[model samples]
Target: MTNQDSKVLRRNLLAGSAAVLAAPAIVGTALAQDKVTWKVQSHWPKASGSFNDSLVALAKELDTRTGGRFKLETFGAGEIAKDREIYNIVRRGVVPMGTISPAYILGEAQAMGLFYGVPGTLRETWEMLQLTKNLGIEKLVNDELAPKGVVMKAEKAYPTEVVLRRKIASAADLGSLKIRSAGTMLEYLAAAGASPQQIAGPEIYQAISTGVVDGAHWGAAIGALSMKFWEVARFHMKPALGITNDAWIMNKAALDKLPADLKLQFLSLLEERYFLRSVEYLQQEAIALNTGKAKMNVEVVRWPDDVLKKFAEASTGILKKEEAKGEISAKGTKALIKLMTDLGYV
Candidate 1:
């Protein structure tokens, strides 16, 4: 074969090999006479790549791992319960498994949001994993789910940053600006002089577009892309404030009902799948937002060191004040700060 023909054949061979490597378990499972299936649901729409993409891959992985005997039929946001309702729905065993932002239900367990997104918390995936492992928060957090007949199997961090339509060159720019924020972030934004308005994630885009809100402090790249916030917001800020933890939880009753072997297999697969998909999610989001902004002509702004320092100082003070006021318990606040400090994030 000519050199060009040889290269084409080699490329095709590699692609074929990769497909087999990625899917060996599926082919094996199709041949199995005995197997089980799982019904998994999520609280995010299929359009958001992070939530749906992870679910789809997880389903495929489970199918492969169990030689097709175990499979997940996944549903996107609102297909089962509305986003806000997914947590209770899953906890009540309305669904076998449901993916959700555990932090969203902090009222149910005050520690949830603090563990989910403590300002100046984990930035990178590895650092996040380390914190989860070392802080003993993972078990404590998961235990809280057990009582609801849900077992939090996996958690992954998504970088959350501040995005503004108006340029924020310094702390002064935040003065009196009404920023859409949630939970602890509300305090952080307020400390910066931006009046934090409590709005649902879905409402942020319209609020910003219609001038109902000045800006939103939410997910870094993926959330920005999924919400199409860039269309209305001209500026994307750098130096992310923190990360949010999204979890995949299995209904404990459903898991208890599973055959022991299958349960173990599922747990193992869930863990691996979460780690793999989380990495892919962050990378994909980073690419999409970074490239998408250039195409859309949105300016990505980096805060000056002095500006970032001011934010950190003010946010730290706000956290301390809240802890003292019992807004967040002292134990929760101390544990979180200790974890962040140990991880070198603070």
Candidate 2:
């Protein structure tokens, strides 16, 4: 072989290697250009609490992690659809994703009440997470929810307290007052003689102020302060109504359209958000309670021991009624009861 032949062979080998290395970059750039953007609506209005802030942060993190190939546009309650309508809207693909409390949809599926944290069960976030993760409650819920065309990605549990326009020293007092509430909590309140009405979060202040309802079993301390619940309701009832779970769900069809890598990225971000935000919720709750009492003049009232016992009894009855509805409700109720029993709550 001549020197010219050797030099040509070396040049060809180098060119082939460069082409192989460039393939991935070329493909990646093309994929990047085909970016996806999804709209995510939350049940809570924008800036309603730290939880809402966390949603915004999740969107920004997803964008960064996906190299800007995937983006999320988030809207708070009433921005795109009413809070109760979000589940159907997401399922219909009107918007690709949304956050909601399963309890809000209990009318559609009685079993969904189990996912929202039973009125007298799952006292803490970790306990609820354990029931959902270790005890297979999460799988049960996803299996049920998937058939409806919406997929549950993550669940968030946060504590809530009751706010009242009129002071109540005992559970019996609740019966004399009309209260705004929903789900099993409403049922329990009714058993105690309270006239329980369903009211939207945005409407609670007006309802209480204008004598539409005497009080509300509303959101966490921070959320009530955000909505100025204290302006109408001066008393903040403690021993939290139970930590309820809010679901972050996506349109199954829309999620299926995501590339494999993007889907993994989205799920990973959700897990991160769940753990971090859980901690942030407690911190913000403390701040809200302190600020509400000091600056807002919102007084904390502890329910009497007898009243709590009565509430617990009523809660058990409501769970039994829900369990009797159907097989799905029964299965969910059994799982919850087992957890509560194990934790000595039952």
Candidate 3:
């Protein structure tokens, strides 16, 4: 075929694929005979509580809903891919799919920080849901990731909380202690005057248990309870940080192999899981906090009004700084500012 003809055919193929993906997902149960099972590497460790269970639930539900024809076999953190490297692994087809935090890849894709979590700029789960679903955070992330040959469909968003070895009265106290953190929270912590270190998920427990770091912020109460961060750090801070550090990413080539009908069904499952997981984790956070207080002897510390004021000032500054990162980051920052204004936060 001529070069023009080849270009036309490729455009047609791409358009056809887009149509299939854009179709309103059919919510009914229908199975195909493809018999495809993709090995999925999880960013969460098997020992992690609901984090791992949530993945297990997805695998089982996918199997049952697809009549056992489409499924996922999950491997925990570092089993095949480290938490930070899951995106690269999934893109390279080392595994067809994996969980990754956009925060993990910001060194190269700073635009994704909008999806991972923007500390201080957003507050409350409802605010985040609004930003993601209505303010274009989700679509923006999907669009930016397309050129990189990876597709993100779901999320594992929860709070980025801190548990310190000792309590402090204000944000100024943060400067005296070293903390284990990651993503935008680490940036926020550092800007707020705390010494923050980016450590992998699995190593956080040991890091806190020993004197490597004074304390850490993983995922609020649930994340702390997952690895029992309470045992090492006796003080848990209240009013946890923003909910983020999550994206369910997959290899485009592997996703394209599925028949159109199954593809829609699979995407629907992910959307459903996102909604369910949001509620599940929120509930789990409350329960985990209770468990820490009653059974584990963890003291919950509520920062003073002045300390909250300090954090807000620092967080707003960081959000403004994010706008300088890139085009998508700026767009996200703009959307968040509008949302914050609408909510009377600014």
Candidate 4:
């Protein structure tokens, strides 16, 4: 064929191919949306509790709200992946989403943990919410997750309270006790005159029951109920040192594929659920504290102003050290301090 004829034939073929592909695109877009199955795992057990329960509930809500367009298959604690490995698993897309402790992975994203709990930093759940949204803490968390190919859908703060086998009302009371603490709480407790050790969530019950440690600090409402903490310790302290923040994370690639409206709806569901559950969970925990249904009998104690002041001082020192070590970004630290000052906590 002549050169001009050859070019004309190629153009016609390309047009026909484009039309064929466009037919399916139009049909698929009209069929509601693409159905995607995503697997989610949590750091908590399958049992109905905070971390795991929240994961399952969120998954169910997502499936329901999306009319089953998106399916999330959830694995309970240690079912498919261990709690400690959830971050790597989600990052690699082994699971599309999972529940993770931002603080637990601080070594990966130093600023992420600081956004959650930093003893004396955010004393209450309300303060935590404000700090998270104020400094764009949620976005900071999302940005950190991006490098790992994960995006945080929701972050929930566990109603915090310190648990001790013995009564501890003063900094002096802490000197004799060995405690199991995690993240910044470890350092804060250590500086508060207690010997603090780092331990995992699943190990706390056995660790305390066996006297492997004197006392351990975990969640107040959720931990108290899930671990049967009352059976192991005599006292459930009021106004725990700090709440544990767990993030519901999704694989960034997976999140990117959802319809734009679906993505917005899904995230809105998470935000609404986070606020509602936190309030309800704290209230449920209060009821549990009053009923005293925990396996072992225990008394509830409250930290005095003097001891709290000591804790705050120690926490401040730890925060400064973390900043010096470059574990927490200067930006995050400054934003946190500003929030604390505005709230009159600093």
Judged by lDDT, which candidate is best?
Answer: 3
Better of 3 and 4 by lDDT: 3
Rank candidates, TM-score, best first. 2, 3, 4, 1
What TM-score would each prediction reach against the true structure?
A: 0.78, 0.88, 0.87, 0.84
TM-score: which candidate is best?
Answer: 2
Between candidates 2 and 4, the one scoring higher on lDDT is: 2
List candidate 3 stretches off by more than 4 Å: 1-31, 108-110, 304-306
TM-score of 1: 0.78
What candidate 2 gets wrong by more than 4 Å, as runs, is 1-25, 107-110
Against the reference, the lDDT scores of all candidates come to: 0.70, 0.79, 0.80, 0.73
Q: Identify the runs in model 4 with alpha carbons over 4 angstroms from their true place.
A: 1-26, 29-33, 169-172, 259-261, 293-296, 304-306, 325-328
Q: How many residue pairs clash in each candidate?
A: 5, 1, 0, 4
lDDT of 2 at 207: 92
Q: Which ranking of candidates, highest lDDT first?
A: 3, 2, 4, 1
Which lDDT tens digits does candidate 4 get at residues 1-346?
9999999999999999999989988887876676778777777665437655577677788889888887778777777776558888888888878887776776766676665567767767776766676567677666766877878744576655777788866778778888887777777777778888877677777898999887776667557666776677767776677755777877788788777867787778888887777677778777767667453466777776777778778887867865664534666777878888897976
